[model samples]
Target: MSNPNEVKSTLKPAYDHVIVGGGVAADKAARAIREEAPDASVLIISDVSDGPLYRPGLSKDLWLKADATLEGIDLGTTETGAELLLGTTVTALDPEAHAVTTSDGQQVGYGRLLLATGAAARHIDTPDDDRIVYYRNADDYRHLRSLVSEGIRVAIVGGGYIASEIAAGLAAAGADVSVHFPDSRLLEQMFPDSITSHLAEVYESKGISLNSGFFLSSIHAGRRLTLESRSGEKVEADVVVLGLGAVPNVQLAEEAGLEMEQGGVSVDETLATSAPDVYAAGDIATFSDPILGRRRVEHMANAERSGDAAGRTMAGTRTEYRYTPLFWSDLFDDGYEALGETRTNHRIEEVWNDAHDAAVLYYLDGDVVRGVLMWNTWGAVPKAREVMQASKEGRLKVSELAGQITPGG
Candidate 1:
């Protein structure tokens, strides 16, 4: 989609590599390139001018108080002394022409291009809706901070991390918060019913409404909106927020003629896109998970790990990106952690209580330790990880592994 002469005129002879997207993945890739290709020039381009900031940690500390600043958090300058292009959005990529253009009409040439565009919060396709806010970036956090003042009634739609974390923060701020989810349990796809119920109990204890198995049908704007559940129940809210998961930012890759699958850029173990001289990682790339034996997309911790690996690989050191999916969440005073993929068939076998602040759920698929759910048990994660690693390697059995890997007394 470019004029031949114009594309030809924009080619630059120098870059060791170029990274598009300014999120965690792009930062990781750039760092890896500098480490491996010490003499090569590297460049990073992104629409967000603030550079790189830790997003997952932001919801916990920064967004809770209205005074936190997000400036100077960018992933520091490139390691190879490469150029940084801030506040620039790449509008088009002409792979055939070996050039990419930004929305502001800046043409960039790259020897190898890494697309780690990441994802944005899913905004519901609603008509005449302006009251609903979805938090994704630093600006969104700041906006929510200002809107949430003190003792405000906040309604969070969707389940999982966003809804849970926002509810926790709002409750801590002395606001009446309601978290609505389409499922009866929190993180239904990842956590078991028992775990979700436990989280619900904790939230309820903190004066937060855990409205699971409910959906928002429509909204009205008058400083309050109406929410209808599938069971015909209704709710009124002061401010509404949606955390309906995320859709991968895949337009740039798709337009460049890179292959994609299951709404993500499909890649092998190496994190290379189907197109030549192109790569992808983070929430936008789907790859085979050796632990689960399936093609999957991990959004948080695993995504960063894989992104770092891809950056290293692009920098000239080749390594496979593989890790069991691990996650943790905090709700008020209670904290929950889980490792590996939970299987429905894995009935909880060994339930243990320790220090009255921790509980462990051991799941077994036949004789294998398929999954684990830990509450207030931050110390046991490492041992559980080891057991899961051994299980993935076909070397551990649930019955025999228990006594060997007992929770810290």
Candidate 2:
């Protein structure tokens, strides 16, 4: 093996496509750019020491599944012939000059720029501490995994999507996980109380503590690790983990004078930003969805699909991103796959089997169906998409949605 002192290669004078932020979206964008323009010089810039990866799996499969390997999550940027500047951040962007300055003080130009600079985790307003983890990425996964041992008390803040997954995965891995969130139930903001209650039961069944209405205000690392919620209640843990949702990394795009909407870079159906030859995808891009209005999807599926579209369009393939992406999550023995908008505010309709183990939930805005959730249901994403399309076309009504898309259908 080469010496550990080996230096990273200097970035080239310029690249045809320079994608900022090394995550799933950037990885997918690089692969698509190479596929469309085989000879294009592509570069991916990421602050993570180990470049792009299947980030979603780090919360579940990489930790719980015996067959899951680190190599399985690798996006293989080298195989795509894309140069990677790892452990580096894009400090500045110059859209007018088609160039970017990185944290390492290297300036590079690009023919076409794709700002796939994903979202950053929202953290408590307390001062930074080593005992805390924002827990948004692969590096965080590795770090947290390293800290896991028998009976280690871990305090996890937030009970939303990533938080719940991390809590269950850690509990399975033998960590004493106590989850704290403002909501009374897990995923209360996304799913209805009944399903979210089911999710809470799943976690409780696994010996994980669910602390509701606990607003974590500050963490003090004393003799043992004291975490105090807003109500003056204090709990001690060995380590603290933050699993709150993410805030889109829009500062770079905003500073470049690119138009922004809905808390992310505003892109057309083609995924092109207002700036010439500049585009954005993944969690940082809020694209106009004909059926769902404008939405910025944070899941991996949207990143992959949007990255593919942005790459092709950047390479002169001009593609419209009409594909509606679906997201899935595995929790204990149950899981969910859903598409379009899923929120607590929408009217929800559920059709369940007699066993109640499988069900399909329809989320509607009045008579218009806007989203679908296949809970513990399998093999019906395509059918669900067709259902949503029918709703979009005005051919389907809310009353006609029962059994439209259900388990194993």
RMSD of each: 5.3, 2.2
171-272 per-residue lDDT for model 1 (tens digits): 777778888888768767655665667777887888888877787776666657777766778788777888887777899988888888878888878888
Tens-digit lDDT track for model 2 on 21-134?
A: 888888778888888999999888877777777888888887798788667777766778888887888999998899999887889999999999889899657546666788
Please give the TM-score that candidate 1 achieves against the real structure.
Answer: 0.85
Q: lDDT for model 1, on a 0 to 1 scale?
A: 0.71
Cα deviation of 294, candidate 1, in Å: 4.4
Off by over 4 Å in 2: 1-8
Return the top candidate by lDDT: 2
